[model samples]
Target: MSPIVVPSRLKLFGLVILILFLCFPYGGAAYSPHMASVVRISQIYSGGGNASSPYGCDFVELFNSSSVAV
Candidate 1:
């Protein structure tokens, strides 16, 4: 019968580290546009802002698929 060689704890740990490095390949503090979202002009008004206007300036309304506001 052939002998089976079980890896030592330290060797196993190193193997796990190598596997992680190989799988991830790189690291960084990064963001994805897909995870976030893109905002689009939902509405627009032609009138200039006045004292009567609540929003101030010629305002534009933006919208996105996400419920969370930016």
Candidate 2:
């Protein structure tokens, strides 16, 4: 029939425990197989205006779509 008063330290501890319980699964970074499969490609095109160049400006680039840079 009455409210219970909890000490400040106890309250803080309870809050921390609650947060950890709610966030433990997602607190750290996660990886997805679908994202791992992603790939990026970059290409360069050459035009007739640069016919004098011995090598056309042709290049290729690749990238990964994960949170980590590769």
lDDT of 1 by residue, 1-70 (tens): 9998776997889999999888877674477776455677889976667777766668688778677566
lDDT of 2 at 66: 61
The TM-scores of all predictions, comma-separated, are: 0.34, 0.33
Query: Which pairs clash in the backbone of model 1?
Result: none
lDDT of 2 by residue, 1-70 (tens): 8999899999999999998888886777788777657867655545434868666565566776667665
Q: Compare the candidates by lDDT and give the number of the best one.
A: 1
Candidate lDDT (C-alpha), each: 0.76, 0.72
Off by over 4 Å in 1: 1-7, 28-30, 37-70
Pairs of colliding residues, candidate 2: none
Query: Model 2: how far is 9 from its true place, Å?
Result: 0.5
